[model samples]
Every structure is written in C-alpha cells, then in structure tokens.
Target: MAYKDQKLSEEKVFKDPVHRYVHVRDRVIWDLIAAPEFQRLRRIKQLGTTNLTFHGAEHSRFNHSLGVYEIVRRIISNFENRPHWNNEERLLCLCAALLHDLGHGPFSHSFEKVFKLDHEYFTQQIIIGDTKINNILEKVSPGFSQKVADVIAKTYKDKLVVSLISSQIDADRMDYLQRDAYYTGVSYGHFDMERILRVMRPMEDQVVIKSTGMHAVEDYIMSRYQMYWQVYFHPVTRSAEVILSKILHRAKELYESDDFIFKLKPTHFISFFEGKVKLEEYLKLDESIVHYYFQLWQEEQDDILRDLCERFMNRRLFKYVEFNPNLQMKQWMELYQLFQDAGIHPEYYLVVDSSSDLPYDFYRPGEEEERLPIHLVMPDNSLKELSRHSDIVEAISGKKRTDHKLYFPKDRLDAVEDEQLKHRIIEILYGQGEVKDVR
Candidate 1:
C-alpha cells in the first residue's frame, strides 16, 4: 500500500475531557501526531496567562489540537458519500486541522504582538520548511505539504475545505469553545455542538446549516460571545497579558542597549530581538524557556526588566480603570506628566489596552478580513444568511463592541511620599472621592 493510504495496525484513542475519546486510525495521522514539531505544542498554553485567573485553564495547545482533529474527523464522517463533499480531500483536511496551530510560540499572542510575528505565517513555513513535519508530509506526496499549508492559510482553491476548518462555525471554533470552556470550568461556552454538526451540509463553496438547526447555531454564537467576555477576556487574565507583553518589551529593549550585559544570556531570544528569527530558533522557545528567563531576569540589574519580570513571574499585576482615550486625552496627558514627575517611568508603568469583538457579522464583500457569515439551508433548499432568520442574531449582527482600560501600578501610586501628588493622581484616575482598587 502507498504510504499515504496506509492505516494503523490498530486504532489509537486519546481519552479527552471534552470529546470523551479522540480516535486515530490512519498511519499518517499517527505519525504526524508523533512528529517532534507537533509534539512541541505540548509546551504552549491554549489560553496564555488565563491559567493564572482560572486555575483549571492549564491545558496545552497539544490538548486543543487533538480535540480539533477529532472534531474534523467526525465532521468528515458525516460528509462521506454526501453530494458536494469530495472524499479525496479528507486526509488533507485532517492534516491541516491537526497542524493548524503548529507555529504558536510560548505565550503566543504576547510574543506575536511584541515581536511583530504571525503564527499563521510560521505555520505555513513549518509545513514547507525543513522540518520533521515537512518530511512526513512530503512522504505523503510531492507537494502535499503545500496543500496543507494553503488549507491552513485559507488560500486553498477549495473554499469548501477552507470553510470546514475556518468558517465562522468550523471545527477550530467548535473545539476551542468547548475545550477552553471545559478547562476554564465556565458554563458560558457550552452549546449543542452535536446538533449543529448533524445539520451541517456541504455546499459547492461552503458549509451550510439546516434551518432546523438555527436554534443550535444561535446558542453557539451566543456561547462564543459570552466566552469572550467571561473567560477569554477576563480582567485578571488581561492584567497578566499586560505584564507578559511588558516583560517581552523590556527584554528586547535591554537586548538592544549597547552598554547592557545580561546576568544570564538571553540566548533563546537573540533571533527574536534581532527580528530575523529562523524556524529552528523560533521552535526552541516554549513556556518553560520563557519562564526560566522571567525567573532569572527578576534578579537582573536593569530595574525595569527586573520589575516587569518579577510582576509576571509572581503575578503582581497592574491595576486598571475604565478609560476612553478620545474623551480623556487631557487627563491622560496630565497623568503621564504626573507619573513622570513622581519618578515613575510612564512608558513601562502606564499602558492602555483595548479589546473589541463583533459577535456576528453579515457578509460584506470588499471588506478587509471579511469573514463569511454562517448560512442556513431552508426547507425549500434555498440558502439564507443566519441573521435574516433569527431576531437574536440580527440584534447584534455587525455591531462591534469595544472596551479600553488603562493599566498602571497602583502600588507605586500609593507609595508616592508626596501626599498632594498622590491625591491629585488618584482624583484624576478615579474622579473626586472615588479612590479605590478597581481590581
């Protein structure tokens, strides 16, 4: 038998918390799971810094990836022998699903933000680059690896395949919602995924849900909305994220300083600091390596680096207040000057973090980052966009909600010996007579 067509001697199953059991039968899938590059996901957290807030959210990307693969597997099982569902693309879809998050770094989003890295770009590179993953994919076919990369990058000619893995209601979202919800021990992410899956129909260019399942789809969309606020965007988790980003920023700043020398060399971060990270150098970094540096840097001579690292490593997170930048520019300027006057480095100590989400959006052509809206197949076999049929979806459809918070070291503000300066700063931050810990 061709290597690409080979099956495992016996089915292997991973007992999963959310999915119960993740079954693998293909030899290719088994080998891909055992590949060193895929195994690296074990060290990357599914929700960076969220475990600090929700103690149970310590599950790794490896766990989530397996869950995603299982979801796609079940989805394909339902698609078999159905019209508009091409069976030839099954393995490609599975491989793409399993390897979708291969390039996520330690504290993935923070590292990406600080270093201007794209995990999706790195994901494609890993599939096409010189790596174990590439070698295994090459054994499948001459250019099979590229196919997987295109599927992940959402550039494949097969829109149906791309939709299956990446649409508004695809396996990736389905798995993470439940998986993250399960790990975080939250009730919000729960939805009837089985019903949604059962009603899924593969169309010429996309997957459509049977109108009968519109209620389940509504629940799923609402679940995603709630998960964003309750778990993924928890204030405490955001505080930790702020510290992690600052730690990376400080490390890069110190690395670029000509006079500074590290007490322990930041060898793992050299390429990233220089902005020319090779694939191998990128892979060498994981949470363990990052934490090792954070712990050691807590003792560094550079006070900013030491302080930020200590905060992240010990969870001495900055406190925040509701802030609107446009209306409070004058207040912000005054606060910035006051912080400087008080001998606090405003650059590192003061931060404005904003988060926004569109719970659901109708399709809009020519829009940047346009997401294809979920479509429902009616009883008469006509397709209609979801928001048109559900009042619940229409209410919030295309409406973007945003929030901004200004994070600062409240402990530092309290320590100011100048009573007049301390009270003034507090008054500006919290308004008159409203001084309190917002955390």
Candidate 2:
C-alpha cells in the first residue's frame, strides 16, 4: 500500500475525563497512538509524586496527551476556512500534540534531575528515530515525522503551528490545567477553556485571543497561578519528590562504588548508572518498573538505600519545613550536622526543593524564554499585550513566584538519642525562627 493510503474511513473517538471525547481522524494518527512508545505513557503518572498528596492524581501522561490532542483538534476545527490558517498542517499539529509527552520516564522530574536527561530531547528522538512511531509517521508522508518532531522542538518554521502546541496559553497548558484539576479534585484548575478556544484567532505568526474573551483569558491566567501553588508546588508533593530523587542519587552512588554490591541488579538503569542512557533503554522504563526496583532495593544491604526504598515504596515520605537557603545558612548547616550526628546520611535525609512559575508575561523581546505574550486583538484590529488591558493578569504579570521547602525524614529525627540536640533542631524549624521568604 502507498503512504497516502494511511487515512481512516471513519473517525475514532476516545472517552476522556477532562474532555468528554477525544476524536481522531486519519489512519496515521490511529496507528501512532497504538504504537508501543505512545502506549507506554499509560503507566507513567502525569503528576508524578503529586498523587502522594492528592490521592486521586493517578492520571497518566497518556491521559493528558490525548486531552492536549483533543484541544488542538478543536482549535484547528475553529481555524478551518479562516484566512492565515492552512488545513495542510492539521495532521502535523495533531500528531505532535499526541506524541509530545512520549519520552517522560517514571517519576519524570526526579528521574530527569538525577540522570540529567531531557525528556524533550528523547521526545524528538522517538519521533524521528527507528521506532514504531517514526515508522507510522514516515508512512503517512516522507519527512512527515521530522515535521511533527520539529513542531515539538519549537524549531518548525511555522510559528503559528508551533504556538498551538507550546505558548504562554496553548493547548498543552489548557488541557493539563483542567485535566489535572479534575483528577486532583481541586477547584483551582477550573477555567473557561471552551470560551478561550472560541475566542482564539489564527494570525500571521501566532494564535491570539479576541478582545471580548479577555475575562475568560484572565480566569485562565489566574487558574494557572492557583493550580501551581495549591497542587503543583504543595510541600507534601515536594516531599515525595525529594525522597524519590534521593533514592536515585543513592543508587547511582552505590553503582559507582567499588565496595557496594547490589542484591537486585539494576539492569534497566545500567546505562543511566554509566552517566548516559540510549533511547531504547530510556523507553523501557515506566512507573511500574521503578516500583519493582524500589521494592527490591528494600532488601539491599545498604542501610540508606534500603530505608529510602521502603519509605518510597510504602508512601512513608519525608516531612518538610519551609526554609530559605540564602538567609538560613547557619540553621541549615546546624540541622545538617544534627542529622549526621544522629547517625543519618544527611545527604539523603536533608533536602531543599524549590519550584517557581511566571503566571503571565508582557512580551519581553529577547528575554525570559521568549514566550510569545498573550495578545488581545481589539475590534479595530489592534493588538494589545495581555497584561496591559487585563487588570487581573496585570497584577502578577512578569512576576516569578517561588516556593522552597526543606525535606527530612521526621520520624528518624524524632528518634534521636540526644534530647537536647532534638530540642534545638525543633526550635529552629518551627518556632519564632521561621524564614520570612513569602512564596
């Protein structure tokens, strides 16, 4: 059969919790979804360690990927027949949206930090590499796979299409905000996504919002702000991420040590342990594989590895105290020594985790990742950068809010044999000594 034969006779739809239904047309997209690489997303949690805090945030990357594709599908439908919009790019946009999160491994944030792997790099690799996804896209059209990969990498010549997949307010964020809100059962992610889509207009270079939909747009900006703090940056979630990162760090240390021997071989992570991982090895990992390894590490001879593995596998995560590394250097050092003196590996036990977000921007020409600021197209065909006209977004525009929390195994700290040392540690963390950094 010819490459052009990859078009479906009927549309296929998926029932999604965030969007009622995610519709797919064309055999290329259908085949891409069935590819093993894309299906692997089903086992990787979207929020990573957030489920430890929210309990219901067990949604997978596959779930968010489909929702993003569905949003783009609707956006394209709205742009159809409109000037400056090219129907030819529709399939490319859909494929990129569906495969954007393809490279996320188990516990993505911690995994990426410990291994220094970029999920985005792996994402492009999967699209253009010798994988089933690449094969399907190539069959659709020669160079088609590269086009999808480029759109994801933000290097595609078509800025308009790239903006749809990634921008200050694009389909990816829109879908995840609402979908994450729904799964976590939090009211913060609620926003008028349908209204925002209705008001979106395809322009010469980027997608812009209609002036009339400014309120809906403001609500979106605000929704993102709340979700970041309430759900994404919640200290409890960061605690789990801290422990998870430490586990990876501890394992890597043991892997490099001549004295350390593993009771359970880290076969899947051998490449990572060597400081680099091939695409094939990276793709083999999912949340289930990580869980299996953690369970096995619980039986390891290393006290630190065994304890951390048990804590993570059993959800007995570290407890956190808010602290500023800049201002509280003395206190941080004191506690670091206290843990060490108490017979705990302070490196794994004491952790400082920070998360930050810029709610909105007013289009700085060459700075700040150059996120195309949201533009409100007025009735006179005039374009005003979002923060100028919307008071709600203007208040927080271009401002970066950051949260920091110090994580440690509280149960172990409480078991310290020295009563005076324990009292001193508690006084600095909880009493009048709290750091004044307002997130």
Best by TM-score: 1
Residue 248 in model 1: lDDT: 88
Error of 1 at 375 (Å): 0.2
lDDT per residue as tens, model 1, 101-166:
999988888888899998988999999999999999999999999999999999999999999888
Candidate 1, lDDT over the whole model: 0.88
Q: What stretches of model 1 exceed 4 Å from their correct place?
A: 356-369, 398-400, 432-439
User: What C-alpha root-mean-square deviation, in Å, does candidate 1 show against the real structure?
Assistant: 2.3
Alpha-carbon deviation at 328 in model 2, angstroms: 1.3
Question: What TM-score does each of the candidates earn?
Answer: 0.96, 0.94
Error of model 1, residue 206, in angstroms: 0.5
Give the alpha-carbon lDDT of every model. 0.88, 0.85
Clashing pairs in 2: 8-27
Residue 220, candidate 1: alpha-carbon lDDT: 89
Model 2 segments beyond 4 Å from truth?
Answer: 1-6, 357-369, 398-400, 431-439
